[model samples]
Target chain A: MLFDNTDFDYEISFLKIPGSDFNKEIRDSKFLSPEEGFLRGNLMKDEYVPYKNLTYFKLTPQNEQETLLLKLMAYSFTINDLNLYLDLNPKDQQTYELFKKYVKEKNRLEEMYSEKYGPMTITETQGSNYNWIMDPWPWDNTGGSMYV
Target chain B: MFKYVKHLNYPINIKKKDLKMAKYLLTQFGGANGELAASLRYFSQKFSMPDEKGKSLLNDIATEELGHCEMICTMVHQLTENATIEELKAAGLGSMYTEHGKGIYPSDSFGNPFTVTYFAVTGDVLADLSEDMAAEQKARATYENLINMTDDQDVIGILLFLRQREIVHFNRFKELYDYYKKKGY
Candidate 1:
């Protein structure tokens, strides 16, 4: 819950960032490309695969599957990040366009990933068996098996 | 009614393990100003908020805080996962180790377990909304301190992202407050 309190620094800067013309302009401008930055990725580096003890899968450089998955994760995460920002900055055309573009890309990649490997989302599952969980867990960026 | 997504919102791929930093971050996870309380407070307050906008704002922000909680836990998990007993003691996680044994426990970095006493659910729309705005700020401040404390770029990047959400949430809560005030609520 690191965030439900009345923060001191937050009180000082609460309305300052959004209300300020300069800050808002910069935020809404295309100058800020949020693609690579702020995307969701584990800080675990090469360790920990959520619940399962690594079946001893040592941290290996991202395989081809991992690389593609990382890209997908980045684009999907960018959408989430921008969506929240857009809620506040509705008039930001650049942000809107970037968001739309990312949406397209994310959709394309999800479709591709689903076809090649497995569903990333519930809707992506082709068959009715709910076999989507058959693939690597989302946090398992290394695509290593817990039993390895 | 929430669908579980098997992932952290902002990622926590900490390359370096540091129990001290993890301990400090524990405050934001289960501490008074942490995400868990934020999520619970807002989610609970939604039922009491008068207007649709205020209700939705509380609902959405509260839900998002749950995601933040996952990320904070990830940080804590990785930070202490590989630490030895001695290292844990040095990082001041000794007491925590005694209690949870390197497992992620929803307590402040100081080993104070989570308690609902940190927040108020006064059922007053204005009062709750006002508190919501202040909660976002405190979160932002905590993120700032976290960023300043850590040298890891990965950690700092996630911190910055979380910090930005606090700003956005504050803005939205402020807007909801203004809207309700204008309506003579």
Candidate 2:
């Protein structure tokens, strides 16, 4: 086991807008699951264009750590894609609301992930220990190997 | 004003060591149509944008391009790890080893160091956005070529994701361009 406290559940779905039909603009905009959003590199289905019609192979997390990190990546990518859209279409109320929900969920996930897998950013560091310089930095093969 | 995030925008864990592929991938890192140039181009152009939309779009895309730059560097670092001197020479990376020695340098595949000349920042909003759109298309094409060079699934997945990002960026730049045009900016 990588850590003793590895019992956190990660079986939650993400990025679905409730009462989505009310907003005509949002109804036109399609969203992908956080996982698909991360894989496809765009949250908005309309914006994603696959190169050569080749679908990216799905990622399979090997462990709890991998699962948690993948979740974080998915959530982060979704938020980022929405951010770009919001920057251009700032008045889309439903989209903004969805963005807020994703943001809140991402924050919660970050906190949970930090406690289990060390701080991904300096701000997530807790107590007296500085785990920021921990081994397997993002460049290290092992650090980011979860995607493969 | 950037906070450090010790994670990749997309996760990349390449298990194979391919020096030749790394050499080709360098183009995306520092080539003429590379992420570094894209980042700097928008970052420089944002200040001259006419209004909030242009500024926000450029600034935000600039910030995102920095992340892409980091991703490219990380890919280079991992691809070149554990390479021996002979291996580097065999892969036509002897000159790279001579100077950077496995370190990630911002240079194109042809060993030309990164220069601002790779991109231009015209003060005119329409012109800058047009350049940005072209840059994204060029990046997309470059990624396609890179994908063709590699049979490694690990590398291909990343290239595909990045290629998709280029499409998104290009669309955003086009939308901004059209918006500015309609507003007579």
Worst 10 residues of 2 chain B by lDDT: B4-13
Shift in Å, residue B157, candidate 1: 1.5
Q: Provide the lDDT at B51 for model 1.
A: 59
Tens-digit per-residue lDDT, B95-166, candidate 1: 888888867889886788999998999987788889889998898788887877877765676676677677
DockQ for every model, please. Answer: 0.09, 0.44
Give the residue spans of candidate 2 off by over 4 A: A1-29, A145-148
Give native contacts recovered, as a fraction, per prediction. Answer: 0.07, 0.75
Return the TM-score for chain B, candidate 1. 0.96
User: What's the lDDT for candidate 1?
Assistant: 0.66
